[model samples]
Target: MTLLSLFTQARTYLKHRPYPVLLMAATPGSSFAALPGAQAPTRGTGTSFLQTFQNYAFDGFTLIGLCLCAFGIILVGRHALGVYHEIHMGKAKWADLGSTAVVGVCLIGVTIYLVTTASNIL
Candidate 1:
């Protein structure tokens, strides 16, 4: 089978098994323990609700970044599972390639967003 076939299969699998796949993808965040003393620096700054909202919007961008990265990793894992199935059947070699390439593209987009952050000083 061609590389395109593998990608097609991966896409079909993702489309059909979205719930379990998404659940597995989200599982990693479960192990992330909250750190102590991680409160905002402005907690006692006596800011109004509006100021607090603005601070959360700014600081919360990191959360968005983390979610995007997690999504990409999940996609890669889903694709790997498909490849594993195909391998056991003694079929195509390109099945996993398509899923991994798409994952690479996702990583590139996430990297671009991270690098272009408004607060990036470096």
Candidate 2:
């Protein structure tokens, strides 16, 4: 396959990953049902799609989750780029390369926490 095609597939795959899906769904205008297993709020006339969506999307937990997921993707991608440069161009210092891997792992951990906790919070 062409390099561009590979890149496109990679991007598409990343966007659909669970963390990214949760992050995107947390954005305003996205739909949210009462989170699974949560007791529904009593006594409301019921919520419009937009309102229900906004309510969850703007909540603190979802916002934090989205941030974490986004940071994870960026860090991981940056680390990969560093590795590529180190291998092909020999332009990155060993310490810089190593630091990228460290940051990437940390970001992944944080992302997992944020995503799982956000689901519970909803």
* Per-model TM-score versus the true fold: 0.43, 0.38
- The local distance difference test score of each candidate is 0.69, 0.71
| Deviating ranges (above 4 Å) for candidate 2 | 1-71
Error of 2 at 37 (Å): 21
**Model 2 C-alpha lDDT per residue in residues 11-89, reported as the tens digit of each score:** 8898778797777878755454545575433323246876665555546556677776887788699767868687677
Write candidate 1's Cα lDDT for 1-122 as tens digits.
99999999999999998998989989788757654655763334236878776666656775676676677667767767777778778884774667666776777676667746744632
